[model samples]
Target: PSNNETEQHSSQVDQIEEEPVRYELPLRTNRDVPPKRYTPEKEARRSRYPMANIAKGNLSPEAQIFTTSLYFEEISTSVEQALESKV
Candidate 1:
């Protein structure tokens, strides 16, 4: 009898309700954060990887053309500049 009363009370206590969730939009704090600008020198290095890979075997007819482009020249120039600046 005591066990049944305890179980009934426990079940009633567990039936308490919960509040629904409310959604809010995010507030931006840094409105003045400037957008990124791309330069030709920066873009040259970015284009080197694919060209380098394609020129790996030196098999493609365009491989020579690809490696000899102005893009690779910029990459080489940047690397040399970096090394020179260190000394």
Candidate 2:
């Protein structure tokens, strides 16, 4: 390598090294709001219907179990039919 080429390469590397790294951080909002204090009426209302607040979407446990059992029965019947046909 020539001396001029080596100096140019080193100068380019030094310029890259001298550049300051800048970090763009997201703006932070004030998140120190005080928690809400429950009144006596609110507390009583919450305690009154704890179960009602629970999320039991569409199918209940009994319905889910029945559906699962029916699915397995259908799969087993298909398997039995396939085996009988092979024999």
Candidate 3:
């Protein structure tokens, strides 16, 4: 190729390389996990999820009792352990 054509091609390549591709990311509560964004479809789907309902304070009785039992069990076991170990 001619010098001018090669220089122009190199300049185009340089310009292309200088601009980095950026991707938009959704809101995240922490570094690892992205937060749940409520779209209409997701709202409908998550409505049937017990954990999701618990998050929204719409827990069913069974879920409430189970979660309460699990919570106290974990707390009594782990928290007491932590206190004992001075952790």
Candidate 4:
């Protein structure tokens, strides 16, 4: 009976060794702030107000609506000079 008990204990140890062990890792997530949601009403309200920031590009905001001869004068002069130089 003692020999049988020892055999049973050895078999139990063998069963435990045969099974695989697992390691679990914690999940990661984005910690940064979420972006603002877009709405048509908000865009409309923004469009109603004039932009405070400085205008970009060669042409001014006022001249953009009506492109007068002054804006193209520099371009035309440069082209005429280039043509004369070639001749």
Query: TM-score winner among the candidates?
Result: 2
| Every model's TM-score | 0.23, 0.29, 0.23, 0.22
lDDT of 1 by residue, 1-87 (tens): 699999998887776553456788687776787766755565444564564465456457576666667465533358778787677
Q: In candidate 2, what residue range of length 10 has the lowest lDDT sum? A: 43-52
Query: Which residue pairs collide, candidate 1?
Result: none
Backbone clashes (count) for model 4 = 0
Better of 2 and 4 by TM-score: 2
Ranking by TM-score: 2, 3, 1, 4
Tens-digit lDDT track of model 4 for 8-77: 9999999988968778766556447565586556544455445444254666877665554444454435
Give per-residue CA lDDT, model 3, range 1-87, as digits (tens): 899999999999999889688898987658787667755564333445564345636778887788878756634357668787664
Evaluate model 1: give its TM-score: 0.23
Please give the CA lDDT of all the candidate structures. 0.64, 0.70, 0.71, 0.64
Q: What is the lDDT for 21 in model 1?
A: 66
- Return whichever of 2 and 4 wins on lDDT: 2
Model 2 stretches astray by more than 4 angstroms? 1-3, 31-49, 54-87
In the predicted model 3, the residue pairs found to clash are none
Q: How accurate locally is residue 67 in candidate 4, as Cα lDDT from 0 to 100?
A: 51
User: Over all chains combined, what TM-score does candidate 2 have?
Assistant: 0.29
Give model 3's clash tally: 0
Query: Residue 43 of model 4: what lDDT?
Result: 48
